[model samples]
Target chain A: MARAATTSDVFNAVAEPRRREILTLLVVGELEVGAIVTALRLDQPSVSKHLRVLRETGLVHMRRNGRHKLYRTNAPALQPVHEWVSTFERYWSNQLSRIKERAEAKMKQSRETGTSEKES
Target chain B: MARAATTSDVFNAVAEPRRREILTLLVVGELEVGAIVTALRLDQPSVSKHLRVLRETGLVHMRRNGRHKLYRTNAPALQPVHEWVSTFERYWSNQLSRIKERAEAKMKQSRETGTSEKES
Candidate 1:
């Protein structure tokens, strides 16, 4: 068994890329520490450290299953991060929508032209 | 002027709370380093350090305005973060709507009950 990490806030806890990888892995389902280590191909100590950080930050929930400790992401705990990032979403969403609309229009025009040529 | 920070990815750069605060302050408009210092109520060097990090990460754009350096957020750079967080949106969005629907139904039920009592 590994010692748990001291408390960390969401922002500080997720600073490392490895931690993010751990999160993406956990999003699908729960896994034991060894399973997580295998999934991420990380060493035991480093994975343990990141898990501790995520646990302390409330980003992940842990439970004891007899011998192994199972870990799973608590998605709602990321609301603050989601809210913060959302502030700037308006800037990109409009541009992306415009880009999508243009692509759709072009595709529709090409399809229409193709059909007309086929008929001719 | 302070030296710029080395390049950082969005996740790592935003890990610091002060940096997020600095980002919020810059979201509205550009500001000089001194103005940021005053806005955040942080010391000159700490503000400079964060600015450097943001600049290096490409999360912020720095321009020269006479003698002062102007800083503004590059919102599109956060697309990756936005996309990553959005993955979990489905979980919350549905849950929130269900909660709202329940609350609204309760209010409607109470109104109907009140009207019936009044008629009786």
Candidate 2:
């Protein structure tokens, strides 16, 4: 019998910053190996290795278009990750929202003070 | 100068399934070391090790409450992880939504067809 998929596999594959950057690049659109290599400024083999891990974890999809293999983000594989992170969103979201609100308030205050200062 | 925080450190710490589960448990409320270890059903040393990694990554906070150490999820530490994952959300989100739709549609279809045979 086949083993059930685990979240560890997905998280581990995505933990590498380089791999995350590659995924981000692919998010914009599909790209060939060369495009990714040039954009990331990483060794071709290293890029290939990260891609292999992502592909293995089902987080990425690749297709052969003539000679080059084009890679794209595989979204379904990422659902578990989102779900896992979302569990704590209720706890953290409020804090982030508050921080944002404070920053915006500060900016507004600064703008108002600037106008008054200029008038003075 | 201090080194900038790396996403790898955050992602790698969360990548461990046990550690993730611990975070989930802590999300509800603060818990002591004993409670976490018992809930996880792992060796004391193993739980300690996981907690150490979590604390080092800034993903968790601990305080001494009387005789025991209470642990809680540090929401700020997780923001970077969330941002990193959100980058690829657009690409994968649609695919997952489609799969969910298909699954729901199939279930609805089966319900509509009362004559359908049950699977073994």
Candidate 3:
């Protein structure tokens, strides 16, 4: 199968772990490329490439500050991704609640058995 | 750069729109391949391929029912993706709050000006 272009959409762009890390770092605030490189311990060119994909996909915003370019996450771009994943949230939550109910039932059964034994 | 394998991780596996559609469809309940093909309007081979990636990445679970195979979403596999994207939730929420504040301020100013005009 032909691979989809990473820069084509928010989901594709964020699929790369490096790009996600870059976006995570930017969430704190805008940072220059050099600062990103140092923070992630990645080389400058790799960081630039990831940032370019992110910028093109509208996942991050870049602005010029004199000779430097600063980047920050365009959080709204991630809304679609978040909303998509959130729909499945109920499945996990249901599993959790079921486990909680089982634990409570076991505790109650043990308490009732102890009381019956004491009465006998 | 060499493209990462889509089957390598949940993130890459879900980067494809078709695969996301397949997962969404499976969320309601387990379904066989033919049902998925009919619902998504995708050819059997293409749907099978996407399901393979989802299965390999543990995003979906497969089981045999007679001669047919059933598929369902392994929602917990998506926990990492959900957690990562959820961190950016505050950015959009903050923007919403800021917009709300501006509208409220505008309304208060209009009310105050209207009262002053009436008094004069």
Q: Highest lDDT, which number?
A: 3
Model with the higher DockQ, candidate 2 or 3? 3
Ranking by lDDT: 3, 1, 2
- Model 3 has a DockQ score of 0.64
Model 2 chain A is weakest, by summed lDDT over 10 consecutive residues, at A1-10
lDDT by residue (tens digit), candidate 3, A1-120: 677788887888999988989999998899999999999999999999999999999999999999999999899999999999999999898899998897777778778776432221
| Ten-residue region with minimum lDDT total, candidate 1 chain B | B1-10
lDDT of 3 by residue, B1-120 (tens): 776788887888889999999999998899999999999999999999999999999999999999999999999999888999899998897787888887777778778775322221
lDDT of 2 by residue, B1-120 (tens): 222233238887887778889988887889999999899898888888888988988888999999999999887688887777776676655677878887777788788885455453
Tens-digit lDDT track for model 1 on A23-110? 8788788899999888889899989988888888888999999999999888887788889999998766778887888777777877
TM for chain B in all models? 0.78, 0.69, 0.78
TM-score of chain A of each: 0.72, 0.72, 0.81
How accurate locally is residue B28 in candidate 2, as Cα lDDT from 0 to 100?
81
Q: Supply candidate 1's per-residue lDDT for A74.
A: 82
- In terms of TM-score, the best-performing candidate is 3
For model 2, residues A69-115, the per-residue Cα lDDT tens digits are 99997866877888788777767788879888977777787787764
